[model samples]
Target: MANTNLKHSSPQGGRLRSAVAITAILSLYSASAMADGGMASMCFFITYMKQIVGSVAVIAIFVWVMGYFEKKAVLADIGQYVVLGCMIAAMAGWFVSQAGLVPPSCSA
Candidate 1:
């Protein structure tokens, strides 16, 4: 009789665990790389992120309007994208604050 207790090795068995471990290692490496700059991430979040969000909002509105006139998009379908853009623009400040990236004071 053949042994039924033998474990069969599969090609996909460890893929998920390997991926998670690799991701964790990469995350740690990136975090360490960013650690050298101290406030670098904060500065980037404060200065560049706001501008990016605002630009996205402007672009979203422009595209939505253009599509509306061209008859390529329905009003109902486009509302979500426009609303999301506006919401992101509106919340840019809050998002920055949440990221804890207050710029250094000039008094120093």
Candidate 2:
């Protein structure tokens, strides 16, 4: 019985352990990467705005469609996507303005 229980639980336990290990590794990677100024990630984020927005929009549409078919839960994902998109766009715009890619309308 103990052996059977161990056999039965090993795969699931291994998966959980691996997941936790991966999470820790990724967290460390991101923390170290961001310990500086995050110049690379910021550049990537700016360059990939369209891809990010499209990916999020696709997810939102998928959720909306699922909600349509399911009809049990409201499709709140689209709103979330819109909010995220707007926030990213605003931040990107700010970064661009700071980088002097776009000139400020007003002088300080």
Note the clash tally of each candidate: 0, 0
User: Which 10 consecutive residues of model 1 have the lowest summed lDDT?
Assistant: 99-108
Which model scores highest in TM-score? 1
TM-score of model 1 vs. true structure? 0.44
Per-prediction RMSD in angstroms?
Answer: 10.1, 9.0
- The Cα error of candidate 2 at residue 35, in Å, is 15
**Which parts of model 1 have CA positions greater than 4 angstroms off?**
1-36, 74-76, 79-83, 95-108
Return the TM-score for each candidate structure: 0.44, 0.34
Q: Which digits, one per residue and each the tens of the lDDT, describe model 1 over residues 23-95?
A: 8975675576578575665454345555666777777777777777787767535755776866866676677
Please state the error at residue 106 of candidate 2 in Å: 23
- How displaced is residue 43 in candidate 2, in Å? 4.2
